[model samples]
Target: MTKSVDSTAPVLTSVRQRTGVIELNRPKALNSLNPEMIDIIAKAVKNWEDDDSIDQIVLYTTNPKAFCAGGDVRFARDNILSGDAQLVDDFFAAEYTLNGKLATYKKPLVSIIDGVVMGGGLGISLHGSHRVVTENAFASMPEMAIGYFTDVGVAHAAQRMVGTRGQASPALAKYWAITGYRMYAADMLWSGLATHAVQDAETILDAIVENGADTALKQHSYVPDGEAPLA
Candidate 1:
């Protein structure tokens, strides 16, 4: 049954068979995470987590340029400057809590990233059990560019990821934290940040629902054609 489970105002969401799909829909803001979006996603995930009929959760976006650029920092800045400290506090609290929930989701969580993803977008995708990226996928953690540090538990993945160099080093994670170096799908897959890279990621969501992830991804997964500079 196709049912809208989350906010259609911006964050479009629906249930397709046993899969609960969350689509980042705020293209005007590059799908930046706002309190409302956070609330909707968190609530929907919680609902699906307890729903026995739901077999998995899927996150994707339709924007051609970006999956999610990051959190709505402009909103945070404006609210903080307006002395609405409570609102600012609530936003981060909800967002961070939602991050934790996504990281620990009970069911198979799949993130299909086909475009630019950074900051909060990384939060949404990197924590998932299966991160499928397309050739167009690009990513970074730009918090450092703004005089802030990375959050949403990205440091956990960064420090732990074993690149093709066959070594896991904290220095590598620190380099990304400080430089915000741009990375493509090849770099992501080679670094173990993204689990699978495919020329066509279009089949992932539906295929996983019908054929299961192992069989579905096996059919489409391939080496990214781009150069892995980080490798």
Candidate 2:
């Protein structure tokens, strides 16, 4: 039986076997990362690490339309118009901190991307050890359009992507930061922006539980051919 988590919560967290499951829960808002949601997710991750019963974290979203569209920039814009600078500062600080932590997290971090993943969404999942995308997944970094640069470890993560010759180039990173191009599953996987692509997300949790993340990834992950999207 599938039971729903708290509808009022911004993020619903539960422990399933040895996996700590975190579901971004604001479907109406498309799971947009607000200050409250950031704090909740950070605290949950830290607590789960301390809990010996939990061995890994699986981050997903309740919203079918979006994993997380982006940060609550509209809220920040409102605050900025009202001259409440503290809110904007606090939000970015908390978010960037969380992103940094996830990048270096000791245990396995599995982020399931099955819908729209952009901006802050990219920040969270791209930093994870395993980013799992389904056929429905789509991602982008359109911060440039808003006169903002890519933040949240994109600088580091983008460097890991390589060309067809297995050589890294800063040109790929520069192109993405400037163009803010949207990428689909095939492009994401081919460019190394996403680690794995499955036909569906149905088996992800079970595979991780039964075989551990690395082994499970091998079973479910796929790579698409053709030129690298950025390179």
Candidate 3:
């Protein structure tokens, strides 16, 4: 008897229980992060954090091609092209705040990284307590390629992954830092950026539920998992 919350504007859905799952539903935009989606997710996460019924959360996006390609570049591009300089500033402020909240979330958080997980997407996933990657997973911090500095708390997390100052060195962060290079799941795991490499997501998800691991949840009993194509 899982309770679900669906949002129209932001394209997000939340299935509530002891262990909750949030899905990014806007596949058209490659599940790109936008102001509305950011606000909704931030509010939902805050609400769930205080709800005793929720013990864990799994964050995922609908775009099989991309877990999240990044922020809504078109939005920014529109503003810039229209000479609306303030739009970029506002977007970043809200987005970064959301990222910070995620970084400090109270309960166990899990992210299933299957495809393109770049820029803001990386921030959302990497901060989780358990970050799972599939063979199809690809990740990068490519802000520099677009004439932007890496935000969404990447500076700290990247440094942690690659070591202090080492994250800035060419031998380490250069792929993403300079060229916005995307790394495959195997490489990501080898680089110490991802935790588990799951080959069968469906089986794993079923196990999590059948094992009664989410006793805290009130409604939903199970979540489906499967291979998602790259967006």
Candidates in order have lDDT scores of: 0.84, 0.82, 0.68
The per-residue C-alpha lDDT of model 3 at residue 92 equals: 83
lDDT of 1 at 151: 86
Best by TM-score: 1
Candidate 3 residue-wise lDDT, 85-197, digit = tens? 79888998999888888889998787777678888888788887767766677888878877888777766676567421124333455445766767775556555567666
List ranges where model 3 is wrong by over 4 Å: 1-10, 162-171, 209-231
Least lDDT summed over 10 consecutive residues: which range in candidate 2?
161-170
TM-score of 1: 0.93
* Residue-pair clash count for candidate 3: 12
Worst 10 residues of 1 by lDDT: 1-10
TM-score of each: 0.93, 0.91, 0.81
lDDT of 1 at 121: 90
lDDT tens per residue, model 2, 87-108: 8999999999999989888888
